[model samples]
Target: MSFFGELGNPHFRSFEGDIPDNREESIDVEGEGREVVPDATILYTAASFTDRGQVLVEPTGPVLGKAEDAPIDVVGITEGSRVLQINPQETGAEIVVIDIHHTTAQGEEREIAGTASITVGDDGVPTLGSSEPVEQLSTSIAIRGAGAQVAADDHIYLQYSLYEAETGELIDTTWPASPILLDLEGTMEGLQTGIAEAPVGSRLLIQIPAHQAQGTDDLIAIVDILAVHEDEDVDDDMESEPTSTSEPTELSSTEGE
Candidate 1:
């Protein structure tokens, strides 16, 4: 008799339709196959849309949050196409509009308030221009919704963008991709207070002072409230639990190549 044991570990797996991607970066796309994403990311969830001929993968990487492991939802990838970059954010939102724009003189260089002209491109992605720096946190509702209002400690789905306060440079955004989830507690204090009481389906513009933005320069975030729940609904939506039937491709963090 031989003794045998199996170990289960949480990792990323790539699957197309019902078949798994066994070969290294060998996802066939027309004549050229889909290359593997080189970035170190943990696949949060794997959703297959065979009916529409697509495989939706929501992976988590570092970019737009208070910590290293943040929740970011990128759009699904098609069969023939490849996913090069997958960004991660803990909690945020995105939109293009400015209200209550102002600026104050700081020495010689005047800092802009929350005043900036935003433009939405053909892809429905927003682009923001540079403005003066805002030292105080402020929020404005761009689009109001009639749905359920967001409460304290509520789980919310959001699509957001982060930009430099004065430079208006693109930091991170979930536009043209997918929305991420935040438990309301696993985020910054400014974000928590800015999003609280906002109704669902509403877009908001929030300005964060440097003190509240993890001691970094003042930042601006555009948030979209997609859905909100008071319970642990985001866990169910995440689909993070490992399944025995499927084999996932493990991408581990290894030092020195």
Candidate 2:
């Protein structure tokens, strides 16, 4: 018997919608017959109402957030129509605005701050710019709220977003999902040292030099220290568990890809 579940996996089924109008025209639109998933949008061209032979755009896809803010101008199409806003009732998450400064692959320096969406400047391969090269691993607590400080061996919950310090590219984030459980003693050396004495509700910006990260490349992380709890008692059969020395491997996020 096969242990893998690929054979048992179900395929997506489809249904056809009744024709809205008897007026027939060739479906010459882009993304014709493509399936749009949840929290997505699409854009297409159709025969113009007045000039039936000429094509015009309905710009925003019928689905929500489906490339609503896509930079079509990158491809030199500037006159395309677009959606002006997304209703929170339809797109569940509250849009957050954060300031981030990055230098692109073309060496262009840019600052994305203020009213633009958090996912606004995701187009380019950007590196987090720094005036001075990082000499050592560093951690700074941005918000210090009233709470108990984390112990070195404590079991706790953490929410974080990891970025590359030099390129400012986002590698991972744990927002919009449940906070991750961590045992400080089993985490990476840099991470364990970084949050050793941090308190709950603390927000930290950490810069880990290349020598202590996942790869030879330097790493930048923004962490929110959440709740902490004690380990529960376990039976002898499970008591000899080996400590995990591996770096964090699972990435979580509530934000759209």
Clashes of each: 9, 7
lDDT of 2 by residue, 4-52 (tens): 1111111112212333222332211121122333322322211111111
TM-score of candidate 1 versus the correct structure, residues matched by position: 0.47
* Candidate 1 structure quality by residue, lDDT tens digits, 191-220: 778889987656667787766665557777
Report residue 116 deviation for candidate 2 (angstroms): 19
Provide the lowest-lDDT 10-residue window in model 1: 97-106
Q: Candidate 1 has which clashing residue pairs, if any?
A: 13-249, 93-160, 93-222, 93-223, 94-160, 94-222, 111-132, 112-132, 112-133
How close is every model to the real structure, measured as TM-score?
0.47, 0.41
What is the Cα-based lDDT of residue 73 in candidate 2?
14
Name the Cα RMSD for model 1: 17.7
What RMSD, rounded to one decimal, does every model reach? 17.7, 19.4
Worst 10 residues of 2 by lDDT: 97-106
Clashes of 2: 7
